[model samples]
Target: MLTQTVFRSEDLPVADRFDAWCEIMGRVYAPMKMTSEFAADFRAHLRCIPLGEVTVYPTTFQQTTFRRTPRLIRQSDPEAYHLSVLLDGEGGTAWDGHEAAYRPLDLHIVSTSLPHETWSGRLPATIVGVEIPRAALPLPCGRADRAIGRQMSGREGVGALLTQFLTHVAADVGSYRPDDAPRLGTVLTDLVAALFAHNLAAEPLLPPEAHRRTLLLRIQRFIHHSLTEGDLTPSRVAAAMHLSRSYLHRLFQQEGITVAGYIRRLRLEAARRDLADPAQHCIPIHAIAARWGYPRAADFTRAFRATYGMPPIEYRRDGVRRQPC
Candidate 1:
């Protein structure tokens, strides 16, 4: 039930696209002076999804320069952090006498309380930005400021998870209800807090709930990435994450499942998907099982049969029969 706003420059008169974009930017984010060579016929698109106190804007726009001057800051400042994950093109931001160049998959944060200038390269930049109010983030200003304008990798660790979560939420806006917005906002805020703490080496600053949630997310991501490896197990996962095996089990216990059960369930789910896909029909059953962490064919057959109540071959055959000609 969540609502979203879509903007396409082509919907307006060619001569007015740039001005309209500027107006939209002011309303969506903050007041800023934006200039672009393509202003005459600026081509751009934006989708805005509001999540309680936070908002997500996924946009693709032609090269543009944006400046937030002290005068503008004085006039109005929402005191929010505009965190942008650059998906395409090149760009950089200049703030507080510091400049950082960024490419795709780089996270850039700018504080609305401070004046800054942002510019894109010749190519149109596709960015998924999360605008989070300063009050929503639990970290102190000084701690958060240390990360602003600095290049943070959105390709790995908590940064990567946050980036993925934002992009997924933006892409799948219709999958959620209005009542889910606040909850989504809470999750987003926690991830941002966790990322900031991780970067600052100040995990203790986060509330206990935030810390536990972040660690669980990290563990889940690690398991998904390593699902194909043969050494993926409770002991290996615990060792790699530097946690005791018992603690790992206890963590999964909260979910009403064991660590081993979680791993097996994930593997089975992956295998089931592949088995039901007609395109993968030619892939041997044993080969498909091995690809999903079950190296031994017998072990995979036994597990898959117990979970799905049918042998892999029978499942695939049944799936194929149900497909339309």
Candidate 2:
């Protein structure tokens, strides 16, 4: 699952938010020469979710400046690439002898190991992205480095799909389970590869297995989104993808699970979350089970007990008992 941490300027004394933000940002991302007004009124909010090898950071803040100087690069080389998806306001960055302006939905790549200068104007700003490790991407260093500090249109084709996925993950990653982490990580990496290959017009250079895995990932995503629908069966999934039932079944072979088993397990996992959530104390276990597609309370209880010892009601009771005063 994606571990989450949130920091708000309001949490600390007005005089301390600036320095706090500077320190936190340095640790969450690579070290940068930071320059910003440390006024008492400055406001900032950061939310981080580390999903396996990929780390997602969503930030909104007041005017700020950041520089990745050669000295900082030599001091601590992270060797990671950041894909920044600007959600609001404006920003600009200069690197590798190039400078680019960015707006909402604009995607840009920043190399942590390389020197660059970036800044947000006096206006507030919001941005999100995945911090990808060097080994996660298939492209060689020299080839991938060409995209450093460059801007790409993130509103169409694979770019559009990639941005949508990032947005979803940012909003709902908390619902993910630990077992889902590695699978989601693979999907993130594949999407990054597809987006880069498309941008470089190097689709042919991508590994054959990666191309196939990407297709399966896309199919699984569709299934996940439609799981709540009563018709989220194999036939519906295949029809939605314009694929034959056999072909769709074959796709899940790579994951070592049948399509039906995958869907059932996901639903069960979701039901377990509701059972353990103190916030859902008022909701009945049967209702929660029905909500996740287990319409029959007896069957739901039976399956819940089989997967996790004890019944749903006991699980919820235990959750209540664990709450701190």
Candidate 3:
């Protein structure tokens, strides 16, 4: 599991919880003034995951107002971009004379270098916040600043992918090893750079590696969504994504896999699960094969045998026999 630090207000004395939380906030972020009606007996939870220079915090807290004054910035500034993915509740942020309101699934950004204030409504909120160094992003300051204090959607395009990735990492930290943190952090940073570049219409400014990774993520998403279709081929995927067939092939090659092979692997994996599923036992093997893009039973059998060293029929029988009575 990825290493994580968790903080729960309930673990401390009722009167001390809020103050302790404020101390934590100062340690994790720049010092800020936090106020809430629930401060008397605040109930909140925080999980912090550090990925190298990037850190992810999934927090649940009561409605509170947070303000970072110019004095705080002068005292110390991380010079980082703070992104909040509002999983629940409504909130607003104001910075540098710009103000915007945000709802669930909306992406809100603020710079630690800029004095700002953010407040949630009467209800509690669940937020997945990410802190990325300003220098780590490839975009220029002027261009990237356009996104701060502006409302962005985390429901579509690269933003959606990023939101999903953050939530999955936060929720399934145990699925990852300790050494994976830095690599995971790198992926998070790359996605953030792509997201910011795309948001600012400055995709050309991204390094070749960042741009390629972004495109590869988009292609993979498209392929997974189109996996059930029989005509889901490299050419079709390229055309759908407005790229050439060769480029699509090259992208997959860079990942050390061929386009066709990747598609086949996904399909076979799907079929293998169905073949071993007790609920799907009555379904014909040919039908199951066709359902996952394989039209011919013989061809599916050959591919399945090559990949798993057994025919679909035998595999299903073995799975059934191994089941508890």
- Candidate 1 lDDT for residue 234: 96
Candidate 2 global TM-score = 0.60
Cα lDDT for residue 274, model 1?
A: 87
Once superposed on the true structure, which residue ranges of model 2 sit more than 4 Å away at CA?
A: 38-40, 202-325
Give the per-residue lDDT of model 3 (tens digit) for 213-248.
Answer: 546755765676688999998889999999999888
- Across residues 169-235, which tens digit of lDDT does each residue of candidate 1 receive? 9888879999999999999999998888888784224345444644665576568668889889999
RMSD of each: 15.7, 17.5, 16.6
| Tens digits of lDDT, candidate 2, 1-325 | 5778999999997678888888888888888878764344468998987777888888899878789899999999878888878898767777777666666897878888888877765468888867898888988877787766545767998878888888888888768886777677788778887878777773334345544644665575566567678668889888998999998898798779999888887788778877766667889888888888888999888988888888988888888888886
- Candidate 1 stretches greater than 4 Å from native: 202-325
Number of colliding residue pairs in each model: 1, 1, 0
